[model samples]
Target: MNKNWSAFNIVSVVFGFTFLYLPIVLLIVYSFNASKLVTVWGGFSTHWYSEMLSNQGLMDAAWVTARVGLLSATVATVLGTLAALTLVRHTRFRGRTLFTGMVYAPLVMPEVITGLSLLLLFVSIGFERGFWTVSLAHITFSMCFVAVVVQSRLVSYDMSLEEAAQDLGCTPFEAFYKITLPVILPAVIAGWMLAFTLSLDDLVIASFTSGPGATTLPMKIFSQVRLGVTPEINAVCTVLIGFVATGVIIASLINKRRMVNNARTDADI
Candidate 1:
C-alpha cells in the first residue's frame, strides 16, 4: 500500500484536529485574560490563578472530586480487571450471556437513566445521598469502562504465558499475578486513568447521589456555569486540563522506560 499523504488526507487531518482542539486552545487562552469578561481580552495575566487560591468553595469541591476520583478509580480498576478476567478466561460459566449483557448495558445507557436508577436504588435502600453514595455511583458506572478497556487487551493476550506459569507449579492466583497481570499492566493503568477522568468530569450522577458538603468540582462548575460563564471557570478548567495532560505525559514516559528496560533485559537473555 502506498503511504504517501494525499491532499485530501492532509486537509481532513488539519480540519479534524482544528475543529476538535481549537475550542480548548481558546479556553486555555481566555483563562489567563485579565478582563473579567470571558470573551474580551484586556491583557494576559495570571490573576485568576491567584484568585482561585481564595475560593473556598472551589477548593472544597476540588478536594472532594480528587478523593472521589481516586477511590472510585481504584475500586473500579480492581472490579473491572476481575470481570474482564472472568469473561475472557472462564467462558463456560452459567448466565455468561446475562453477565456480559449487564457489563455492557451501562456503556450504552443514557446518563439520565443511570443517574435516576442509582438515585432510586439508594432511596429504596435508605442509603443517604452523600460522599459515599457519590463514590458508589461512580464506581458502579466506571467499572464497566475499565472492564471494556481491559477486556480489549485481554482478547489479543497470549494465554500460553499464564498456562506456562501454572505448569511450573504456580497456583492459579499466583500465575495470574506473576504473568498475566504484568503483561496487561499497561491496559490496567489506562483503564484506571480513564475511570478517574470519568469520575472527575461527571455531574449528573454525582448530582443525584451527592448531598450537602459533598459537592464535586463538576457539580460546582455546573452551578457556576448556570449563572454565567466567567474567567474563574476558565481558569479552573485550564488547571484541570493541565493536571490531566501532565499525568498522561508522565504515564507515557514511565511506560516507555519500562518497555525499553524490558527489551534490554530480553536482549541480554
Candidate 2:
C-alpha cells in the first residue's frame, strides 16, 4: 500500500500486466504485418484488415455471431434475472432446492456434456441444427452465468423499497420497473455483457450445435487455423477483441454514472 515500496509495486504491476497482455499486444501488432505469414512481420500495413472485411464467408460468420450473441445475451439476461428473482423472493417455496440446482447446474457442467446433451435433446425432438439451434444452445448455457451474476446482487438487494412502493398502491410490475430496476440495472448490464462474451467466444458448444450456414466467427477461425494462422485471422481477432473491449468500457461508464446518480438521489432523500 505504501508509495515508498516503489520497486516491489513497480515490479508487481509491470509483471502482472505484461503477463496478461503481452500475447494480445503481439497479436494486435502482427495483425498489421505487411507479410502474409503471421509470425514474420515485414512492416506495418492495413491490407489484412481490408482482406478480412472483404471476405464474404468471414463477414457472414461475423454477422451470425453478432446476431446470436445479441439475441442470446438479451434473452439470457431476462430469464436469468427472473430466475434470480424467484430464488430471492420465494425463499420458502416447495422444490426450491431442486429448482435452484436446475437453474445453476450449467455453471459447473462441462461444455462438452452440455453441448452433447442439447444435441441429443434436439435430435430426439427432431429439431434441425442451424443458426437457431446455436443461438438456443448459447442461451441455455449463458443464462446460468447471468443468473449467478444477478443473484449475487439480488441477495444483497433492499427489498423494503419495493414493498414500500407496493404499499403506496403501485402494481408489482410498476414497483419493480420504477424502483427495483434502476437499482439493479448495473448487475443486469454486467450479466448481459458476460453472456454476450461467453457466446461470442464459445467454440466447443457452437461446434456441436451449429449446422450449415451457422458457422460462428470462432468456428470459422478455428477451422481455418487447421490450415494455418494468417494475418487475416489476426485482424479478425483484433477486431473482435476491440469490439468487446469497447462495449465493456461503455457499459462500465454507464454503470458508474448510474451509481453516482443513485447515490445523489439517496442523499437528497
Candidate 3:
C-alpha cells in the first residue's frame, strides 16, 4: 500500500480546507473593519465589536439564545441518555421497534417539516409561543441527536462491568451511577454539546417556534442579513465561531484527560 502523499493529494487537502474556511477567515478579518460596509475595508479597527456590545437587540437575543441552548441541551441530554439505556439495556420489550423508529426519524426529517409541525402542534395546544416554546422545540429535535450519540457508545460498551457491580450487592441505580454512567460520560457530554450547538445555531425551528420578545441570535442575524451583511454581523459571527471553537477544544482536552486516567487505572489494576 502506498503511504506517501502525492502532490495532487496535498493540493486536494489544501483546497478542501481553504474552500471550507476561507469565508470564515475573511469574515473574521472584516469584523475588524472600520467601515460600516463589509466588502469595503477601511483599515483594521474594533468598531463593530464595540458597536455590537452596545446593541441592546443583539444582547437580548444573545441572552435568549444562551438560555434556550443551556436549558434545551441539559434536558435533551437527560432524555437522550435515558432513551439510549432503554434501547441498549432493556432487551425485547414490546413496542421497542416503534420507539426506536420515533427516536431516529428526526435525524433524517427535514427541518422545515419538523419546525412547521411543531408550530402547528403548539398552536393546537394553545401554548403561548415564546422562550419556553422555543426551548421545547429545541429539545424535541436535539434529543434525537443526543440519543444517537449515546446509543453508538452504548452499543460498544461492556455489560459485564455492570453485572459484576450488581453481583457485589449494588442496586440497579447504584450500579448505573457508579459503573455504567462514568463509562458513558464522554458520550453524554458529547451529546450535550451537540444539542447545545444545534439549539444555538438553529434559525428555522426557532423562527417558527419563537414569538414576540424571544428572538434568538441566529434569528436576529438573519433579520439583519436580509438588509445586507454589515461589519456588525461579521463581528457577531466571529465571536460565535470563537466561542464554539473554544468550547470544543476544552471538551476534547477534558475527554482526553479522562481517557488517559481511565487507562492508567486499568493498567494499575
Candidate 4:
C-alpha cells in the first residue's frame, strides 16, 4: 500500500508540473513554426523571430516595457525595503496593523478593481495617462510583492549582526548599509526580479492606465490576441518564457553555490 501511494504521489507531481509547463512549452515550440496560424504546426523556421526583430511597432513597445519594468522595479524595491524595515525593525507604532494590511492589500485585490481605482485616481488628479502613470501604477502593486519577499527574509535574519555593528561605533545608517543590506541583498534582488517580471507581464493595469503613445508590450499583445493567436504572439511568448526560465536558473545556481560555500565553511570549522 505504501509503495502504491508513493507511485501515486510521483505521478501526481509529474502531472502537476506538466500541466503548468505544457502551455509554455507549446508556445515556444510554435514560435519556430512556419505556419502563420499558431495552432497548426509547420516545419520549423526562424521567420517569426526575424519578424519580431523587424516589426518596428512591436520593438518600440518592447523597449517601452523594458524601461517601465526597470524603473518600476527599482522604485518598488527601494520603497518596499524601507517599508519592510519599518514593519520588522520598529517595535511600536499606532495603526501598525492597518499599515501592514494596506501594504499587502494590493496582492489580494482584484486586478480589475486596482486598475479601475488607479484610473479614477489619475483622472481625478488630472494626471495624463502615459508611461509615467503606468510606472506609478506598476510601482504601487509591485512594491507590495517586494515588501512581502523582503519581510520574509528579514524575519529569518540575525538582528544581532546589526547590534554588533552598532557596538563597533557604526551609525545606524552605516550599520544598515554595511551589515543589514549585505545580508538581505539576495532577497532584495529576488524581490526586484519579481517586481520586474510582474511589470513585464502586466496587462490589465497597464491597459487601463496607459495612454495612446505608451502602450506596453503586454498591452499590445493582449490587444492583438483578441483578434486571433498568431505566430508573432507565440514568438513574444517564447521570448518571455526564455527570460523567466533564465532568471529562475540563475537564481537556483546562485542559491546552490551559496549552500556549497556554507557547507565548506562548516567543514573547515
Candidate 5:
C-alpha cells in the first residue's frame, strides 16, 4: 500500500508518454494550420476542418466506418461475453483447452493473416465482399479481444451470488441476467468501447476485406496519404483522435465509478 513513484519511474513515464503522443500532439496542433502545404504554418485556422466536412467521399467513409464499428462492436460484445461466461462457468467441458486457445488466438494473430483468412473464407463461400464483409472481418477479430477483457473480469468473480439468486427461484438465465451480468457490466462496456475503437482505427484488415463502396475512414485516409499528407487528412485524424479519446475517458470514468460503488456496497454489507 506504500507504493510510491521513484524519480526513475517518473522520468520513464514522461519519456514513454512523450514518445507515444508527441506525433499525435503535433498532428493535432498542425491540423489548424491555414497553409495548404502541410509543413508550412501560414496561420491558425479551421479551414481544413471545413474542407473535411464538405468532402463527400470523406463523409461517406466516416459514415460507413461508424456503422461498421457500431455493428461489429455490439455483436462482438455479445458473443464475447457469452464466450467468456462459457469459459469461466464450464471449465471442465471437453475441448475446453482448444476452445480457450482458439478464443485468444486472434489476439496474437497478425492482422494481415486474419484479414487474408477471412477474405479467403468469404470468397470460398461466394459472399459478396462489401460493408457486411468488412464488418464481419472486424467482428471476427474484435470478439477475441472482447473475450479477453471480459474473461479477465469473470475469472475473479464469485459465482455464489448467481447461485443464491437461482436458489431463490430464479432460473439460470434469470440469475445470470440479474446477478452475474450486472457485476461484469463494466467490463462488458469496456470491451465494447475497445472493439469499437479497434474497428475504427483498423486499416490493414479493412483494406483486405473491404470491397467497392465500403471504404472506412482509415482506408480513405491511407489512400489519401499515399497521394500526399494534406491538412484535410490531419484535421480528420484530429477529429478521430478526439472521438476515440472521449470514448476512452468516458469508459474509464464509468469503470472507476462502478468500482467505487461496488466497494461502498461491499463495505456496507
Candidate 6:
C-alpha cells in the first residue's frame, strides 16, 4: 500500500509540475527560434528580439499598454483599499451586504459579460472607445482583485491598534495614516502589483473597449497571430514573461524580508 501511494504521489507531483510549466518552457524555447513558424525551430538567435525593438507600431502599442496598466492599477488600488477599509472597519450600515456584493461582483462575473456590458455602455454614452476606455475597464476588474487582497490582509489585522492610537489622542485619520496604513502598506503594494499585472495581461476587455488608433500590444499581437506565427510575437512574449517573473520575485523577496523583520520584532517584545 505504501509503495503504491508513494508512486501515486510522485506521479501527481510530476504531472502538476509539467502541467504548470510545460507551456512556459515551450514559449521560452520558441522565443529564441529564428524561424517565422513557431513550431519550426531553424536556429537560436537574438535577431527576433532586435526586430521586436525596431517595430515602431509594436513599440507604441507597448507604451500605450504600459501607461494604461499603470494608471488603471493606481486607480484600482486606491478605490479597492477604500472599499476594503469600509467593509472591514465599518460593520453597521444599511445595504452593506449589497454594497460589498457590488464591489466584488466583477471578480466572479464572466469576462465576456463584463466586456460586452462595458462596450454597450460606452456606445450608449457615446464615449470614444480608446485608451481611457480600456483603462476604465481594467480598473473595474482589477479593483476587485485589489479589494480581495487588501481585505485578506485586513482580516488578520488587530483593530485594537487603531483604537490604541485613538485612545492616545490621535485623530481617526491620523491614526489610520500612522498606524493602520503602515501595517497594511505591504498588502496594499502587493495589491497594486497584482492589479498592474492583471491590467497588463488583459485582452478581452481591452479589445472590447479600445478603438483603432489606441491598439494595445495584446490586441496587435492577436491580430498578427491570426495571420501566422511570427518571431516578433515570440520576442514580445519573452519580454513580458521576463518582466512578470522579475516583478513576482521582487515582491516575494520584499514580503519575506518584511516577515523576517516582523518575527524579530515580535521576539523582542
For all predictions, the C-alpha RMSD in Å is 1.8, 1.6, 1.5, 1.8, 2.1, 2.0
- Candidate 3 differs from the real structure by a C-alpha RMSD in angstroms, to one decimal, of 1.5
Candidate 3, superposed: residue stretches over 4 Å from native: 1-3
Between which residue pairs do clashes occur in model 3? Answer: none
In order, candidate lDDTs are: 0.95, 0.93, 0.95, 0.92, 0.93, 0.92
Error of 1 at 162 (Å): 2.4
Please, what are the lDDT tens digits per residue for candidate 6 over residues 87-163? 89889899999989988899889888899999999999999989899999999899889999999999999999999
Q: How far off is residue 23 in model 3, in Å? A: 0.6
Q: Estimate TM-scores for all models.
A: 0.95, 0.95, 0.97, 0.94, 0.94, 0.94
For model 1, the run of ten residues with the poorest summed lDDT: 1-10
Q: Which residue runs does candidate 4 get wrong by more than 4 Å?
A: 1-5
lDDT (10s digit) by residue, model 5, range 9-51 = 8899999999999999999989999999888989999999999
Clashes of each: 0, 0, 0, 0, 0, 0
Evaluation by TM-score, superior candidate among 3 and 5: 3
Query: Candidate 1: deviation at residue 74, Å?
Result: 0.3
lDDT comparing candidate 5 with the true structure = 0.93
lDDT of 4 by residue, 94-167 (tens): 98899889998999999999999999999999999999999999999999999999999999999999999999
Candidate 4, number of clashes: 0
Alpha-carbon runs more than 4 Å astray in model 1: 1-3
> Against the true structure, whose TM-score is highest?
3
